[model samples]
Target: MARNSGRVGDLPPPPEPLAVPAVDAHCHLDLMDASVDEAIAAALAVGITRMVTVGIDLPTSRWQAEIAAAHPEVRAAVAIHPNEAAAGVDEATFEALTALARADGVVAVGETGLDYYRTPPEQHAAQQESFRRHIAIAKDTGRALMIHDREAHEDTLRILAEEGAPERVVFHAFSGDAEMAKVCADAGYVMSFAGNVTFKNAEALREAAAVAPQDLLLVETDAPYLTPVPWRGRPGGPYLVPLTLRLLAQTRGTAVDEFAAAIAANAERTFGPW
Candidate 1:
């Protein structure tokens, strides 16, 4: 229930660095006010050496591609978010997004799936069309697919199976129970945990995290949103990933150092090397 005000000025300071370096599986550097270099440097100083900056639309997707191309520590994921999917994609925009997906340093095609929470029922068809196109693009380009499923789990999973999921499919900011976790695990999908898992009311998410296979488990900030506990509601960036990561480690009953290493390995497997 923590909402993002999108106000970055008053965010909390970064916590101490983790014992093992980690990659923020997902984030949006273009949404923040800080320069890309500054954000990368700040995260690197805290042992967050790498991150994937995602794009929700054509323009932002282009921005992410450019930034990732220039920065060694960054990668990009491009797609139109499910909420935006209802807007209907024009042929021109689809062409542009397709080009960006094949661009250098673009590691995935996603943050695209179904979101019934904020999107109206009238637009469900459009969302489904967009999701299908993204799935095809991911498969065509042979890149990972980062999915954003909200309140449309069954439909999302159905479409993924129907369209044939890409080799690497990640449920970013996974919002599901242990049952759903098993379904995704059985399908060889990655369940990425965001800061919301730290909330008191998110027992189901924690259970999902606990059941997630170590090799298939991933962590993300999804910033500047889903800022971890005590810092929830404040703007966040990759530097804040350790907070959620520590919680994930505890939920998995593994030492932070060991778990962090495993998460790093999982990132490599999902998005390709660094």
Candidate 2:
């Protein structure tokens, strides 16, 4: 994964901490400008104390595991992302990725669902195949399945059902509207919202947020991508989670502290003891 370019006006000072600490259900610390320790410290300072650093490829997956192993606050989710899976990646590499998924402190096998948005039509087969493989790994290892569903919502859901989704399935940076939220809610999938849920124009997402069961809701930064409103287009970090969590809380009409606590509990349920 490419690191965020710390261009002028990109990295902003950390926002005020949340009233109570909350977990960042998904993130990509390896893709940010901060080192693992630096990112962890910054996040901890803001009550974003625990996070799952996701992998988009084998090397980064291994790096994610390494960071998780070294830091109690960080857990890892390893997988070859849908876009990367479409690239001529070999089976041996997937075997290696599966090994990484099973490593100590590796809580999930994911960010691997379907992405019709960026991948070409010709490569959809490859992406779906890789997704199935990741599903198997998640099930076999008894780890949560972290999904990255973009425009391929139907196929993503279909494939999960076809393969018998792992007991713990997370829709990382969930991009669905209320209808899809209903489907996920009925299927018992955790919908992890990122900063985009705060956009003024994202009423649909906010509606979906409201539809999600409180126990099934989660939060993330997806930094340095989806930086929340007021700081949109700026590079994001875990410390900025309060902005998104507050927005989610407001959308759900819950107190910020209570919402944060629910998210923390949901985090443990989805990813296990991290």
Tens digits of per-residue lDDT for model 1, 196-253: 9999899999999999899999999998888889888788889888899999989888
lDDT of the structure predicted as candidate 1: 0.90
Q: How accurate locally is residue 175 in candidate 2, as Cα lDDT from 0 to 100?
A: 96
Assess the local accuracy of residue 267 in candidate 2 as a C-alpha lDDT between 0 and 100: 92
Clashes within 3 Å, all models in order: 0, 0
* Residue pairs whose backbone atoms clash in candidate 1: none
lDDT per model vs. reference: 0.90, 0.89
TM-score of 2: 0.96
lDDT by residue (tens digit), candidate 2, 1-274: 3476453365778888987889988888887877777888999998998999898998888988998998999999999999898865688987898778889999999889888999999999999999999999999889999999999999999999999999999999999999999999999999999999999899999999998999999999998788898988888888889999999898889999999999999998888886
Q: Which ten residues in a row have the lowest lDDT in candidate 2?
A: 1-10
